[model samples]
Each structure stands twice: as C-alpha cells, then as structure tokens.
Target: MKNMKISRRKMLIRSACLTIGSLFIPISYATAVNGNRHLSKGLDLIHKVLSRPLDVSISHLNKCLSSGKIDLENHEGFKDYINSLITVFNGHHHGEDEILFPTFEEKIKGADFSKLKKQHKEIHPIAEKIKDKINVTDPSFDNYEEIRNLLQKMNDLWIEHRDEEEGIVELDMEPLISSKEQIELNDKLSKHGRDMSEPANLILPFLIYNLEGSDRDTFTDDMPWILKNFVVPIIWKSKWEKMKPFLLA
Candidate 1:
C-alpha cells in the first residue's frame, strides 16, 4: 500500500509539472521575491529574443554544413544573423554578472557570488572560441570536420553553462531584493521591451515553482503588474496558444 501510494503521488506530481510547464505563464508560489520576479521576467524576455531565432537559424546552417549542400559564402549572410543573437546573449549575461549579481552579493553577503563569477570566466572563452571558429577564415584552414567539432563544443559548453548558472548556484535573493527595490528595477527596465521580456518569462516560471506557501503569495500579490500586464498576456497565455502542440508532442 505504501509503495502504491508513492507511485500514485509520483504520477500526480509529474502530471502537475507537465500542466504547469505547458501553461506558458509561471504560477506564483510562496517565497517569490518581487525583485527576483522582476529579474526573472526580464531574463525570460531577453532569452526568447535570443534563443528561438538563433536555434532555427543554426539548425538550417548545421544541416547545410552536414550535407555539403550550402556554400560557405552563403554562411556570410548569416554572420549578422548569428552576431545579433550573440550580442543579445552576451548583453544579458553581462547584465547579470556585472549589474544584477554584484548588487545582490553586496546586499546579501556570505553568498557564493565568486563561484558564479568564476563560471562566467570559464564559459566566456569557450563562447569566444566558437565565435572565432565560425568567422570566415583562409582556405588553407578549411575543413568541415573542424567546424562541426567547434559547433559541438560550443553547444555543449553553452548547455552546461546555462545549467550551472540557473541550477548549481542557488541565488538567495530573499534578503536582498526588497519590494521597493523591485519597483525601482521595474521602472528602470521599462525602457527595453522585447529584450527585457524574454528573460522575465524564462526565469519567472522556474522561480515560481521553487517558492513555497507564504513567500509565493507575497511575491504574487505584491507584483500584480507581472500577472496582469506581462505574465498572463505576453508570456503564459501567449505560450499556451503557441506552445501547446509542442508540449503535447
């Protein structure tokens, strides 16, 4: 009976996770920090702007590279395309490492900001190496195999870096981000629309899921602006409409 109960609970939990994940907008959990909520929204907005298009473009380029069906000269057209995505990605990480992370570390001492910063240092060189490899070079160095290897390395490094930043290091913002600070940050972030929105949507969901009873209520109630204006419409509802098929698949 105990085993059956555990199995049933696991199934129910999986169902809940799927339901929540499919909805698009992140639900408010207790322990949701207003400032972190704001930051999450900003991050999600920025990520959507950077990732989706880059993934599509890279997929096409990778396929062409594999088949030898596309000319390297044609890859030149995608230079700007690739660069645009890289610029936004770098800018987002730069803001986190330089602006957001420092502020939080200063406010809440004893947190392992150094470790996160170190990850940034390690990940950036890999990113730069990929960028260098992708740039059109001399014919003597030409080899599709080398390019393929670079792409694999770049992709692997990127996935690992994201997991570390988003997972390994738990950013305890409860002590740092006061309600007042969140409002101030929101006011400042109003300038960048799409760039800000991508990151917000991406992180907010994860943040919401992590929060518990009271913290969750406080975070959501205090930041109704997110639900009414941003989260509900621009993110969750929009995602539900668009991403439902993918989720079901």
Candidate 2:
C-alpha cells in the first residue's frame, strides 16, 4: 500500500512533466530568453520521450475499464506498469522540487512557488486513491470503473496545475535566467531524476517500451553512455522482457 501510494504520486508527476514538455512557449518568448536552444530542445525531447508511455498507460487503463472483465494476468501486468510509472514520475518531480524549483526561485525575482508546492501536496491524496484501486489484487470491471473515475478527477486537477507551471516557466521565469544557466539546470535535474529512479531495471525499460523510432533514438541519445550501452542491455534485460508484454499491448 505504501509503495502503491508512492507510485501514484510518481505517476502524477510523470504526467505533469509530459505536460511541461509539450508546452509551446511563444516564439517571441524564446527570442526574448536569448534563444536558449538547449532549453527548447530539452523540453521538446522530454515531451517526446515521456509522451508515449503516458498515452500507452492511459489507453491501457481505459481498455481495462471498458472491457467489463479483469483477468488476473492483465491486472498483475497493469500493477507492474503502475509501479514503474510511479518510480519515473516521482524521480522527475523530486528533481524539480530539489534542484530546479529552488534554483529557479533564486534567479527569478518575486516568484511565489508556494501555490505550486501546495498543488503537489493536494495532488497526493487523489493519486493515493487511484493507486489503492490499482493495487487491488482482484479488481473487477466495477473496480476498474471506480479507478477510472478517480483517475479522471486526478487528471483534471493535474492538467490544470501542470499547464500553469509550464506557463510560469516559459513566460515568467525563463526570461530572467541565462541560457547557460537553464541548460545546466536542465542537466542537473535530469541527472537527479535518473539517480533517484535507480536500479534502472524497470524504469528504463518501461520508458523504452513506450517509445519508438526517432523518439526512442532521442531518448536513448539523452541517456548516460553506460546506461544506454550497458546497463539497460546487460542488467535490466530480463525484467524488461517480463514487463514488455503488458506495456506494449
């Protein structure tokens, strides 16, 4: 149950990062920020990387809910995916809260991050409710319906908060920070996220399973050399193989 709650929070943050990645700050705003290509490219890559998994997860949940039956095999598979999603999601936000937000706050004057902080606090209970449902060992279609409702509610709140945060960063914050600083911050946050999500076995594979073609290549390129060449291939292969079916299907 504790793990499930943590996973739920992680999923929420993962979705939020995807939202941030997809945001389109104005061309004028980009120009005004001294044209930080790193920040722009980094956000776009992050979106591309995370978007597929999010879409796959939501689609799978919807299918399970609408199918009117829940096979134990499928239920267990979904639980594993949820756990992986939780890890990545939590890692992303942990990076933001600990690395990005504090750093950004210092650079940008009179910026009030309390609201965003409050939103994170508020979101956890909603995520916990959905997680509780997902963690049920014998979930039925009825259980799926309950979970679906909870997820819908979570999505609404999360989307609003995520969009607002992105808007703040793009419109208000980026202008104040230098391009080099933004790039360094992005790197630190990315590293922090990967470190926090370690064991790399489940999280790396789950992320890869959802991505394809160019998006997969971009994600792989962004990975640390050892993780891309060795850790994923040599260390996590077995775990990934077991979980791949659920995520891909």
Candidate 3:
C-alpha cells in the first residue's frame, strides 16, 4: 500500500514537471512537435529564392558601376543574368498578387492582406521600370545611375515587405494554418508563377544555382526528376555559362 502511494505521488510529480517544463518551450517549437511545421520554414526558402538572385545582381551591378566592368567583357552574359534575377523576383510577386493573396483571403478567416496587396501594386511598377531599362540597357551602354537608384528603391521596399510578410506568416498564419495546408497552397502558388513568368533555362538555373547546402538539397529533392536529371545539366547549363562569374553555384 505504501509503494502504491509512492507510485501515485511519482506520477503526479512527473505530470507536474512536464506541465512546468512546457512553459519554457517556445510556442513554435511546441507546435512543431505537435506536427504542424511553421509556415515560415517553407516561406523563408521562397523568400530567398525570390530575393537572392536580385541581391547578387545588385551586387554585380554595383561592382560594374564602380569599376567599369560594364564597359568591359563585351556585355557577355551580364544582361541575361540580370534578367533572370528580376524575372524570378517578378514571378514570385505575381503569384502572390494574383493567386496566393486571393486564396488566403478566401480560405483564412480574418486574413486581410489588402496592405500586402497594395505593396505588390507599388512594387511591381518599380520592377517593371527596371525591366524596361534592362531591355534597353547593357554593359556597354546605358545609364548606370538610373538603374542603381531604382534598385536601391526596390531594395528598400522589398526588405520591408519581405519582413512584413514573414512576420505575418510566422505570427498570424502559422498558428492558423497547418504544414499540409501551406504545402498545398504553395503548390497552387508555384503553378501560377510557372504559368505566368518563366522559362526553365533562366528561372531554374538561377534558382537552383543560387541555393546551397540544405536548402539546395531540400528544394532540389522537390523538383521534377527530369529537371533534376536532364534539362538542367544537358540543356541549360551551357546556356548560362557566360554568367558564371555572377552565379553562386
């Protein structure tokens, strides 16, 4: 009877310890243990996918403007390189503006992304301006100051918007949505983006090559087998070779 009483007391103590220990666990970590992957985990990859190319492009362009790499090298792969960066950036927001945002508004209760949508409205035009300039400008000729200044503006706007979106995903959306739902919605979002603004040669290499380490493995593992095997290696790699100086991979 005494041993039975001690066993009950130990169980109660263990229960109390678990309850108190849980108080120290982060809400997101606990949620992950509960089987809901944080929305930010997936979205962060997309954000990097969308932003890194532009960042590298901006960096290259700045170096060119400073040291006149623009006037040298016969333009080579530079123009196409910049285009690929901008295309991925544009394609992502296009998905968000056209599909993702609307879907979220419909599915998620109290999900008012009207401000985020407004940000897209503002962002796209600047992107378009840059696109227009890219269409005309090259390493040999064009106004570097205008391109530089516009990129600065876009960078400022994008950094703020990216943080805002990530915050919403982490704080508001993650609790409300599950890992499964985010994956499903991301599929819809990606399909829309592919339909809108992509050529595999530019988009795939730019995306896959820019990524590294675990992100590259995870993202590549998710890609269609044909792309992972044939299209990228046999067909597309040589095409982007001129841009090697700018590529991360």
Candidate 4:
C-alpha cells in the first residue's frame, strides 16, 4: 500500500475538519472491527479496493434482497444504498475503461480487452434501469418483484464479468506489472471512486461494512488513522443516519 497515493497522514489532515458530525448519536449495532467472515485474499493493495469490496457489495445486496428483507420501512435507505452501489460500480468501470484498460491493452500481450468491454456495455443499461426502478418503486407485498429481478440480473452480470476480469488481472496482468505500477493504478481507481461517491457519508460506511475479517483489517489498517478509528465509531452514524437502517454492517 506504499504507493496508494492517499497516504494515511495526508488523509488524516484533510479529514480533520470534517469531524463536526462526530458528536451525533452513534449506531447501536456492534462494530465489525473484529470481523467474523473470512476474505479471499489476493494482493490487498488492489483487491481490497477493487475486487473484494465489489464482491462483498454484490453478495450482501443479493442476500438482503433474496432473504425477504426489503420493506417499506427500509425503502428509502435501500434506495440510497442502490444508488451508492451503482456509483461505486460505475466509477470503478469508468476508471478501468479510461485508465486501467488502456494500460492493460498496451501492456498485456494479446489481452482480450474487448470481451470485458462488451460485458460492461451490457451491464450498464441493466444497472441504469435498476436505479430507475428502485427510485420509483415503493415496496409492497407484491410490487417489488421487478426490482428484485433487476438487482439479481445486475448482480449476476457483475459476478460473471468481475470473476473473468480478476482471473486475467491476477494471472496475466499481475506478472507483467511492477508493484509500483499496481499501486499507481490502484490509487487512480480509488480516486475515481472517491470522486464519484455522493452524500459522502455512505461511501466510508459502505466500504467498512462490506469488508470482513482480515479483509476488514487490511482496509482499516490502510485507512487514514482518523477515518477508521475516529470517523467509523464516532462520526459514521451521525453522517449516515438516514441509511443506517438498511445497511448490512
């Protein structure tokens, strides 16, 4: 994580003034700092921000919706979450298409960049439709079927696309790139996500809540000291109070 560009010290300094919201009431759910689940480890420098975070999001979303948890009480928070999820997913791909893929196309010999690009093209409309549906649909006993279907479709497409992409990245791409190069790529991609997160409150909570076990450790460990240590416990609930009801962690 040496080259993760947003150094902990820098982030701490940048984020210091944002603690005004820290005084609000904290959430009741116990912190997941000592997480229960195990993370599939690769290189945390990349996968922590890219692969596993998205994977956690997809799985949690599927589980929450499929387990019959969607309801009127959570309708607003859930909608907020869907938007945040899409923002992160869309931003990641934007970074890839704009920054990462071009690098891979130039660097990795015979890389089938088109296949991934094609899948992205297919997934975009589905995600866009999901957002539209989520925004309009109020959950009732029978009204949410289409939203569920769209979410499932979105999750499935993402699963298929990301699995294929991760294999290529870890096997074909990792060997060709230097550690420094990987960090540079990770930083740019992370910046893109940071730039895209709206309502900012939801982004950090989304990231922390989605991660678990050693994966959580790696993310928190790498976070600027102020964010993971102070913001999460003291500031998170106040900032994300609206979405807390529907959040997984």
Candidate 5:
C-alpha cells in the first residue's frame, strides 16, 4: 500500500510539471507539431518581402538625387521602377485591409483595426502624389529637386506606416492566432493579393530582384516547381535584369 501511494504521488507530480511546462512554451514554438511553424515564426519573412523593395527603391532615388542631376537617359527607367514599387506597396496593404486584418479580427475578439485602416487611407494620397509626380514630371534635371523632396516625404510616411503595421501584426495579433490558422490566413492573404494585383509576370520579377541570398532562396523554395524552374528563368530573369540599373547596388 505504501509503495503504491508513492508511485501515485510521483505520477501526479510529473503530470503537474508537464502542465506547467507547457504553459511556458513560446506561442510560436507551441505549434511545432502542427507543421505550421513557418507561419507562427517571427514576421521577418513578411517584413523583408515588403520592406526590402521599398528600401531599395528609396535608396536608388536618394543616390540619384544626391548627385543633383537626373540621368536623362535613365529617367523613364527610374519612373518605371518607382511605379513598380508603388504597385507592390499598394497591393500589400490592400491585401492586409481586405483579407489579413479581417481574418485577424475574426480570430481575435474585440480587436480594433480602425486606427490602422485610417493610417492606410492617409497614406494613399501621398502614394498617389508620388505616382503622379513620376508620371508627369519631365526627364530633366530641372525638376529633380522637387521630385526628390516629394520622394523623401513619401519614404518617411511609408516607413512609419510599415513599422506600425508590423508591430500590430507581430506583437498584438501573433499571440492571439494559432499557428495553423495563421498559415491558412497567410495563404488567403497571398492569394487575394495575387488576384488583385498586376499579373505575376511583372510583380514576381520585382520581388525576386529585391530579395537576395537566403531570402531569395526561401521565396523561391515556396514557389511551385514549375515557376521556379521555368517561368522565373524564361520570363522573369530578363525583366529583373532590365530593371537592375534603376535599382540600388
């Protein structure tokens, strides 16, 4: 009887320890068995995917502006590059507004996305102004300073918006949503973005151009084998190369 009681007590203690230990597991790691750890992991992939292109675009513009003279021959190239950046930026936020945030709110009760939505609306005009400036401005050094100043303002606003949005998603929403659900939501968001944006021919190349080394590898690894093997090599490679001159080194 005494031995049986001791054994029972040990079993209870072991069970209690496991119950407590489970609570201490990081939210992200807690879903390891679900095979959605990639989704639960930090938002680094999303951040890099969205922000790297913006950073490259802004850096290229700044480098050109620093010289105080726009290269007339490459002026149209620069405009195209800026337009591509704007397209990706707008497409990403549109996906967040229409798909990602809505899904997040559904999972997290009492979630307030009004302020974030307002920020999106506020930045639209600034983005449109930059797009308009790129389209209408002459390819001369004459309006270089004006365009440079406008781009600088747009960059500042965009960075602020990006940081805030990331904080909301990573810090606030990540803990609330399960890893499996996040993976599913991420897929939905991506699909919605692809459906809403320009054709993959244009967007994919720009995304590829901005990513390098491990980021590039991870992105390509996630793509369908046919896209990575065929479409990227046959279609997007040249497009990326053509835009290379307007992008940062």
Candidate 6:
C-alpha cells in the first residue's frame, strides 16, 4: 500500500511539472516542438506584396523634374516612365470614381462627385495631348521644342488638379468613403505584424537616387518602412541591353 501511494505521488508530480512547463513555454517553441507550421510566419511576404511603391516613385520623379538635376543617362531605362505615371494616375482616379466615389456620393448627397468626374474629363484631354507629344520624342529623337511646351503645361495643370482633388474633393469625401479607416483595416489585413525590410529596400533606393544631403536623410528617417522586402534577387547587369534605338526619330 505504501509503495503504491509513493508511485502515484511521483506520477502526479511529473504530470504537474509537464503542465506547468507547457504553460510557461512560448508559442513559437510549442509550435516547433509539435512540428507544426506557424500561420503567422509569412505575414511579411503579404505585406511586401500589398505595399504601394508607385506613390514614392511618382514623388521622386516630380522632385527630379523640379530640381532639373536628373541623370538622364542613368534613367534611360525609364523611357516608359511618363506613360506609366499617367496610366497609374488615371487608373487611381478611375478607382475612386467607380468604387470610392459612388458610395461616398450616396452618403453625402450635396457632395460634388459629378463635378469631380467632370474635372477628370476636362483634365484628361490636356494630359492626353501632352502624353501624345512625349511619346513621339524617343531616344534617338529629341523634339525639344514641342516636348518642352507640353511638359511645362502638363506640370502646371497637374499641380492644380492635384491640389484641388487632394485638398477639396478628398477632404470632403473623408466621412463618406472613410478612406483613412479603410486604409488602416487594409494595412492590418496586409500583415499580422510590421515588416522591417522595406525601409531599406524600395524607399531608401528611391530617396537616395532622387534626394541629396539633409532632404534625403529626412525622407529616409521619416519613412522607414517604404520597402520592407524588396530584395532584388535578379540583377540586370548589362546597360547596353536596356538601351534601345528610337527608329521613329
């Protein structure tokens, strides 16, 4: 009877220690011990995929143009840059019109979604004219006269449109679209945890290329999460391969 009681007590004590150890063990270790894949492990990949790099690209282009200090030779690869920019801008505007604006218009009956739509119609033609000009001036051909005129006009018009849309239309539609809240929810859905790699990749490269001295430092410091996981595994080593002759000129 004494021997059986002692054995039972030993068994109970061992079970209690196992339970206590499990309670104190970290979730990551427990997952590893069980040979289970952690669902939370790949959150960084999703964040990198969903993160928007276009805005930073656009801002860098604008800064380069404004400063008149762009190394055009290095950026020859960006022969498609202007067109890409316009396409992206138009698409974003269209998204706001189709998805964001309608819902907003319903809530704010007095809001001028139509007016904004009309403004797009007015702005797009001017942009189209400029794009048409820019498209023709390829690598071999520098139709400096027509290109310069259109570019200057487009820049002025774009700034005005950006101000009106970003300041007036976007400001008013905040409540209806709830863009801030939606963006936050989307960010959370993008990743279970914040990614630390992006700040060193896309954002830093863009800033370093475009900005200099204090301005560059400020941008980098302020936006540390711009390119969380943008490691370029493949490199385009040949510069000559990237360059193409403009036969149109």
TM-score: which candidate is best? 3
In order of lDDT, best first, we have 3, 5, 2, 4, 1, 6
TM-score of 3: 0.77
TM-score, per-candidate, Cα-based = 0.51, 0.71, 0.77, 0.71, 0.74, 0.45
Question: Candidate 3: lDDT over CA atoms?
Answer: 0.65
Candidate with the larger TM-score of 1 and 4: 4
Tens digits of per-residue lDDT for model 2 on 1-249?
999999999778555533332221111111112256455444444444344554555666687666765656766667767666656556655566777679877877788888887777776676677667788777777777776676666566667776777677777776787777876776576656655654455666676656667655655554456565655555446556656665541
* Candidate whose lDDT is highest: 3
Query: Residue 85 in model 2: shift from native, Å?
Result: 1.6
118-166 in candidate 1: lDDT tens per residue?
7667656755665665666432134444555555555666566655554
lDDT by residue for model 5 (1-249), tens: 999999999778545533332222111111122244444342455456556655665676667677876666666656767777778667767877887678778878988898878888877777777787778556555455655666677667767876776677767777777766776776665555565445344456666556677656655554556565555556345544556674432
Compose the digit string of candidate 4's lDDT tens values, residues 1-249.
875656886567446524432221111111122222111122332334434434543564565557776556666766777776676667657767887789878887787689989998998898788677778655543336666666667767777886787777766776777665665665565555555555556666765665577756655554567666666656656655656654546
The candidate with the higher TM-score, 2 or 6, is 2
Clashing pairs in 3: none
RMSD for each model, in Å, please? Answer: 15.1, 10.7, 18.4, 10.2, 18.7, 19.1
Model 5 ranges with Cα > 4 A deviation: 1-43, 246-249
What C-alpha lDDT does candidate 4 achieve relative to the native structure?
A: 0.59
Per-candidate local distance difference test: 0.47, 0.60, 0.65, 0.59, 0.61, 0.38
Residues 108-224, model 6: lDDT tens digits: 677666766776677677657646755543422234344445555555655555556555543455434444444543233223111211212222222223334443333223222
Question: Model 5: which residue pairs collide?
Answer: none
- Comparing 4 with 5 on TM-score, the higher-scoring candidate is 5
Model 6 TM-score (2 dp): 0.45
